[model samples]
Target: MKASHDLSGLVKFLSRDDWAFHFEEVMGDHFWPVMDHFDLDHEEINDALGDHWAMTLWGCAFEDFLTQVFDPGGQTFVEAYLKRRSWKESAQSKAYMTALGTSVMSLYEASEIVPGKSFLARDLIRGGEPVLISEGTATKTLRQWERVAARIVPLGGKLIIAGGLLPFSQEASDALLEGFKALPGKRRRSRTQPLLDDEMLRAAAPLFTHAFLFDVLPKALGETRPIIHNSDGDEIVFHEVRFPLATGITRKDIAWRLQGIPQLRQENAQFWNWLDERSQKGPLKARVPNALAAGTTMEDGTPVLGNLELKGRFLTLMVNSAARAARGREMLENVLGKMVGVPLTTIQTIEQMQEARKGRTKEVDDIPLEVATPLVHAMLDKQYREILDQPVGMLGDISPRSAVGTQKGREKVAEWLKYLEFRSASSQNPHDPMTTYDFGWMWRELNIENLRR
Candidate 1:
């Protein structure tokens, strides 16, 4: 379940309040040394400078410098902090993200050259990255860098990272490709060329007035190896796939058509029991087969082709292995094609049923509940025990039962209960599949009742 309001706003609120986090490291890295170099006339200020509280003044001054000297005003700092937030949220960490994000933003903004008044920003470190705001390639900045380089090249404190570490995703690769085109270099994708930072500085002498250094750990040399995933009984993988169903078939016809597959017949021995129970009469009636069963949720809460008033529903399939998933999909497509006669159109969604459900006024009972329930069970019987232990973001990045161990996690579990409550009370026109679900299992599994009290 999604939060009613986005969580990003909460991050921003936290970033603004935690000022010490942003400035603590930078004060030690640059401010104290810079202060030592400057001659102060005021004895009172000088006496207060040795105290730990003095760093607060240094941080304010640095922020002010970033706002005035770097020209993007103060917005660049905000953007950097947001990036920090994004990185932190992606992992389960919190503190460094907001603090470092804000610090990086200001670092970019305040990174310009004051000619002779302050040292060239590049002279402090080398490359401008993680976001560089005050980077300038002006003639004066270039000449100053040339002078600095002549002085420092004999000594080494820099290393050029050359391209990026690790592989780039397609979208990220595309962006880098486009960006590389603008730089003064050949855009060869396959070449593994390395240029020293000293040579690069000599080539593009007047770099941006960026003063930032990352405490980056070098990647271990040698071939990158693929990590092998070995799952114990406690760890199981689930795959959700879509399969096409044949049109003009009823619930009984569906059971027969799917049962026609040798794999389905062999894998599920309970299929006959379900079909026999659905055939039974009186109030002991079983629900209609909802293509499959409860363990696997349908894409749009659609019934099998037999009940379709407007169009056929896609069979929502799930399996634990890639091989089984693919085989199941191909088999379903092949078998349904034979039964339907018309080329079975494999659908990924049930938008047609969604539309049909919307226009119809009555709570149409297309299929009985008794028959549908057991088939759902047959689909998930193998994986049900492990499902409760899997961590979900909706449960505050903890498993359901684990969420009850702490007060904060319990609050998240309560929120999850509220979300399910919303689902229970709601419907997708007449096609709500949640009604078929027994949610009591969740409460009992998590041991999280008595929330109201």
Candidate 2:
């Protein structure tokens, strides 16, 4: 299939790998080399760069560049192209253009400009300026431009539109659109698939069984500060409450909400000490470095630490946004297949449910385990709530970036799908029952206790 149309699968397929992914080729005729005549240092030349620089060099963002290039413009394709570049570079109020203009022009002809500088050539033909790509014959960094371009464009509101060259045989654009279209529906109407097929009790066959519990996990128990009891006469301590009854009960659901939990900054020395102990065991693998570990020291120069310092209990606030469903699903599959430690489908389902619940209407069927999942699932979905934004943070504050994606938050739909897969696959069974590896104490913590609280 054309690379442009194959974007859906390509994105999903690529996400299974590390953070850095290459999409320059997938861009096809849509992109052109921006540095055809630049005098860049070897290091900058060798690194991956995003096409955004090219766009910026042309005096517009990626999308702006596209509209201008594809739509009718006066000058000869070359003149218009150079005109745009001059404008783009000048807007930056820098000498990047004048300093490298001549070099950029000469490189496009597939001829060397400066001995050790670089060269570039147009590959794909779309509208006016042929899409310049790395001919590889040049000594400069070809890929770096694309890499930088990718980061800047997406982070901004504009989408890095690409069409044509697909790695596989597919209408990459259509597939991408299909996935994009599906994002909202999935977010609005969560897709809940069964975790297992019922099997009769046998001498030895795996069967699924789930347990539910509810409790208030006080910060003090973990060697942190105590929660402040409100003026109400209700209890401050979180007792081991029963199921179903506990399922819907969030901190907000409680009659007299537990109050006065100290902010992480106020966390007493005990918290820091706990972090130290946990750090000594090993790297204390975490999403971010352990700050507490760096703060405190032990009696014999020994350390104390609370293995995983939680920032806050997961938040489940309703949000209004747009998403691409196909992308969400592909993201789920990639995450699951790559992060073997976690399940995929479950999280997706949970995200779908949460998005649906945010709306006034109910769209999808309820899974048998709906009541069993934590209340957070009703809002943020499992994958996003737990994985993307770790249930654990510094001690009551989530990172600013953990919120939105299309804007600046985590992709909620993808996260929920992952969570669903995690919860479902981890359910206990009769013969081959679930173990800590599948449903560990932490899982239990997610389901029952007042974690974020």
Candidate 3:
């Protein structure tokens, strides 16, 4: 479906402002209580970048060109933002329901979810009686045990209620069996079930536990797609992936190196080559899009003779976990090349931030500068940090407790994975998305020369 909103004028209008302020304003108005969940306040948002307009200058041109030139058919911010909201709300509700059931089930028999109170161990049902289920399967079984135990207790008999993960915990199970055997009764009829098959209990047997239900089972049922905001005024669907964010070169490191070597800029190509060689020897984990460049080839079956620059506006990066966030700085250390312009131009001062928060005394903390690193590493770290902390529909900003109760909860448990994919509605390098063309005709000569040669 096509979007009805006009993004061209909007894009032009936004481009004129300091990109950082625009982003901060957009996030502040739209992210809401969701942003609060991550402990990020308005002042912090304003302080995130040293150069508010850096991302705008570096990332915008490609996006603008993509909408205005390459692909005339475009979408808008309003539609995209609304779609993301819907996805987030739906996912949150689903997660909450599932987690509630699982949590209650875990404590079943020994204790129950008492509408508003905590579980009571003394009210367990143990004998044969008609069962009534008010809410859950465990509650029904508990009712049956209660009735049976009452009838048998008078005749010096016993009863046992079952259901819930309590029966599986070594401590709870042992305590239950001991209690059952020691119950006061002339003819005690303890609740019992057939033991697990010998084969099922073998050391090597693949065991399935309820934690698996809360942790791994949901993905098998298809709840991994998350709603993520994109630059082209839209939200994109993404399959979650986890990765470590710790460790990386960093933007400041690059800046320091570049600044230290005054002659580095005199030979940009040579400097890049030397850096690339060191990176090959450096102890760093290569990531997606960045890694994609190492093997990219041209349409005519020829590998292009150029370095891959993971730049531009319309890039959707899936930062699935904290590891990616922590290491993001190092990844961008002098290697990432450049970022979109809007984010870069939005840099703000402590004074501006204080002015913005004039009414709210609590938000007057001075804006802290982002850790400076090389352009590439800083950008990588920034993207990783943003995704690490940004409130995506499924995993980024939802309450940990809320997530555990639904599909989103299950996805959160898989935060150790590190798979990322890049999708773009607009790009300068259609053939090589990792890079962008700052000067439209700049690469044409290189291609023509390669052909002639």
Candidate 4:
């Protein structure tokens, strides 16, 4: 049998009537957060999370139980088990049991994963140099920079992860770290001494399980679909309203009429943008203000309420919400009264647009490599130039420049930068322009280059 199967057998052995109390105590602590958060009892939680996750949680508790000392003399379940059943197990199993008796569970950041082989794990909670771990099953699925709360044990001269591993999302990891820092006696520590001692980490093991559940339960229970709204607090729905121009009207006439309105900015002969002038002045003073007065802007601070483009005889107006589309249509009708014909409107939900975008391939012309490369880079540079000063939803709707002014905000910005860099590097196409783009400048701009690792 595999070593993990033997570990499972040990867990089962400890769950008998003689050791039921300790089993209940550890499992109770592990599952209490899920129960308390969802207001569900033991059976209901199992029904909600299903058998797979429930057993996974149980395994986490079992691993935590291995490190606990039930008696004043420091005897643990593994020690007690070996005392009685040592003769039945092989030498390797005995050694494994002994290792488990002393193993401390802590969170680790996984990297350089090689499927079906191994990966490098750096302890995030205990703070140590990264060590190569020979793991097969987990390496199949573990992503680079993913955090996992698990135990590493030396078995057969190789460090391997224990059976109980709880992978943590960035949100979960942040919650766990915050919870750890809020614990008594940890608040006064400095940066270099951020690592927790083995004893403290082991004692705080239940918090790791709690944080993971807090991150996962909402998603698993179907509560994570965000209700997105525009700055006007209107639920976002894409509205494409097309107004056909009158026979005698020309592009120049349309542009001249549009220019009379202060909100419209002419981009080209065929295009004009309906803009919110207030957004160009500076960052918003407050959220959820006048939607018409304070419209949405791109990352580079181009305040666009909607887009208008001329095609054949049709003048298409694309806006986010129905309210904006209606407003846009009325404004256009008033400006170019007899110059425009009847309008044709098409509406799509945000979810539908997203679904339609998936697997849709764009057709690119075969431009010369030398020309394409510089053009792509220039576009990217322009797009990201004012990104630091603009509000980002990922950084809690605050500008990165503003976010870096505080310690907690700085941490969030660092993680956001790392995520952006990771996604840019993960492009499937090697020749993709994004694959070669450097985020080093962005890190330097934010003054968090030192935390790039």
Candidate 5:
């Protein structure tokens, strides 16, 4: 179905000033409260390169583009829903329901969701008590999950919404998407609102590419297609594979297990290469996506291993086809369970493991980031020093200060600045999103690329 909204004119009216104010004023009006309620720490919404407003910049400009272009479409579902439902008496309620008409709302927008709290976690009933769904199964539960923009994109059928990657995290969003995917197919719920059709989405995709939202939603989501298809229309199917760790096995134990397997060994090598590239700092991040890896444990007892990016004991795999995913799972089972003597535990899909992790006790081990990470109230200053700027002697024996002297030093300094910017940019820390990191000093000192207003 065609969008009744005039998306073409969406960008026509949005000038740099509109965006500067949107993130600073409009978004801040809606965004900050949500962050506070969820205990999500953020300094504030800012346009670092406010002076550079060419129609040509890449990362920052595209981010602003999403801030503007996605407003109408993101509001489509809830706006239509509000039309069908009875209007509430409270003026505040009226504003909450109607707000989606122009802005993308998220968990942060939860408080003013009018009649219903839009930020509350809703569930999809897949036979028993509400289960966390698989990748693309059930986009948004009519009752459980509330952020329409967050849930819809992954279901391959859920309605489109205004929010993009900025407010919510990419990984948590992906996990939610997978939960929707894992829902039993026969009982899947039809979308609450009409989906923006291929024609509309095709027109919409460029807005994403130009806005750089594409960095979050890639063309090939494993083997799955976006519920809203893009024009590039690459016809491929991706499957998520998982091998659950035994009760006692740690992610650190994987190296010993893979000591003899040539294929997995090769795969492990490729994963690190991708991690190294992902960890590199620079403007544009000049990086591909972070390679998802499954490590049992590190030999050194290092709490952090191979980049500190593992998702606990569960090693999830992403392959193109179900057949390949199945085969890979079988191979891992044979290699890990039968040959290597890592005692074959019960085999389950990543979604199944995730679904089950829902009910475990606090003492029981559960998904690292999901069940536990939210409670972490570590000092921002400490994490900033530990994770972002720990220590690197790239210029022999000099700080970023001394390096700015020579041409080679300046180039190295640029890399350091870019690394800081890129890391803070791509960081998905739910507690401390990259936005919370204050890179204002470096931005001024480096005199890097000027950002669009």
Candidate 6:
């Protein structure tokens, strides 16, 4: 029988008069957060989260109830259910139930997932070696770096997660960690400190459901949008501002003028990069004899602000925001003078750009997979090689190379790597070259291959 069947049987037993109050208490604790947060009633929760998540919420609560201690002696709903229904359950079911009674609910980070087979679960709330979970269905759907709050119980010598599995978003996971840190009776020395003792985490398990719902509900209810923004914090809107060459002006004239500008770096005959003069001069340099001192800024650091290209009769500037397009237009006008005519602009949001790409006709001479895969891989290799030494916002603005120098930074880097791998694997097209690219080399290069597990 499936685990859900066994859990349902136990739930039926718990509905009896003798155990109903304990069941209600656990259910209330789990549901109250979502209800209170949205000012929702019991019936409205199902409407809000929909059937799938509502059932998931209930399953999580029921599993949490299995671990609850009812009295000072520590009797639990699982014990009560097994006492009345053990004879009806199979040996495996009985063992599962017995294990659930003692299991604790905690957040876990999944890694090395083999769809329809198994995955490793590293406890985020309680520090320990990762446990291998012999899961089938969840593994098929779970992404790498996905966090879930669940109970990992050993059933017949192999570890299996209990029926209640709550998948958490990154925001929810961070909130849950913060909630644990803020709980009374224990003080955490640092944000990276190991989680509270097992009993404390278990007692505060409802916070897991709360945090998950807090992040999920707003989006589910259409209260938020998945907004993408540029590093400047402006919503991303691609702008292509084109200027026609004035009567006698030619591409050569514009190229010559652009070459003389310090902010524009010519890439080829037709393309130039518009650079930001205000970007930081890379990371700090270490002080040494006859070397640059720490905190001393470099002279040649310029981040790309936009791009310029000469196509046919037009000089085109491409930027990610309207503000950048305006500034780029002014700069080009001041330099080109009567060499360029009045500008024409085109704007597209990310969604519009995606739709435009989908609507475009495919090239007749498409590259073969064998040729394309290597080219794409080569491009990605070059991109990531530079990324290794560049600051990543996710890693607290520290470069991955610098991050690996400390234990805490290494942990963050590992998580960041998992996210990159997961996103690559989740690419929409199965045949996309990115989907097949191996990130194992990245881990090895960073000397954190062992942590890939």
Q: Go through the candidates in order and give each one's C-alpha lDDT.
A: 0.34, 0.24, 0.27, 0.76, 0.35, 0.77
List, residue by residue over 1-453, the lDDT tens digit for candidate 3: 212212333334444325334444433333344235435553443344224322322222222222121112233332233333334334433332222212211112322233322222332223232222233333433321111111001111212221112223222333334433453442344445212222222211111121222222223333353222222112222222222222354434434444443212222311221122112221122232112122222111122111211122221122222333223333433333443211111223334555777877544564322322244344544544444333333243443233444654544422211112111102343333222212112113212211110
Taking the tens digit of each residue's C-alpha lDDT, what string does model 5 give over 1-453? 223322322333334333444435433433344345434333321232122211222222232334343354443333433444423224433343233233322221111121221222222211112212232222222211122232222222223333232322333344434443453432234444212323333223223222222223233123353332111121124455545577677666655665554443223421420111112222221112343322211111111112211256666655433444455556667766832233222334455666889987786555565434434323334543342232334443355555655767666655554444434434444244333445554545545323100
lDDT of 2 by residue, 1-453 (tens): 232212232223323322112223212112222222233432342243334333332221221222211224332222333343433323222221221211111001121212234332221101123222322223332221111111111112222212211111112222222333343222222224211111111100100000000011111123344322211211122211111213343433221221222111213321211222223321112222211112122212222211112122221111111122222223323422322222212122334555767867644774444353444344334433344344222211333234332332233322332233333433344222211122233323334211101
Worst 10 residues of 1 by lDDT: 209-218
> What lDDT is obtained when candidate 2 is compared to the true structure?
0.24
Q: Which residue runs does candidate 6 get wrong by more than 4 Å? A: 1-5, 72-74, 189-193, 223-229, 236-238, 246-307, 330-339, 348-371, 382-416
Ranking by lDDT: 6, 4, 5, 1, 3, 2
lDDT score for candidate 4 against the true structure? 0.76
Which window of ten consecutive residues has the lowest lDDT sum in model 2? 206-215
Residue 244 displacement in candidate 3 (angstroms): 23
Error of 1 at 253 (Å): 28
Q: Native-vs-model 5 lDDT?
A: 0.35
After TM-score superposition, what is the CA distance of residue 126 in candidate 5 from its true location, in Å? Answer: 59
Tell me the TM-score of each prediction against the true structure.
Answer: 0.22, 0.16, 0.14, 0.63, 0.25, 0.78
Which candidate has the top score in lDDT?
A: 6
What lDDT would candidate 6 get against the real structure?
0.77
lDDT tens digits, residues 1-453, model 4?
455338655766766545778878888888876788789777876676789877877777887888888864568888888877777777788887788778887888886678899998888776757788999899987765678988899988899987778888655776788788878766345656655777787888888778887767766777457456665567678999998889988877887888899888676888878876554332222243212123455433445789999888788999988998989999999989999999999999978999989977765777866678778878778767678888776577789999999888887887777666555555676567776676678888889765554
Which residue window of length 10 is worst by lDDT in model 6?
A: 290-299
What lDDT tens digits, residue by residue, belong to model 1 across residues 310-429? 124444554443544455556656766644432232332234445657877755765565676566544443343454575544554456677788887876765555444444424543
Give residue 406's error in model 3 in angstroms: 33
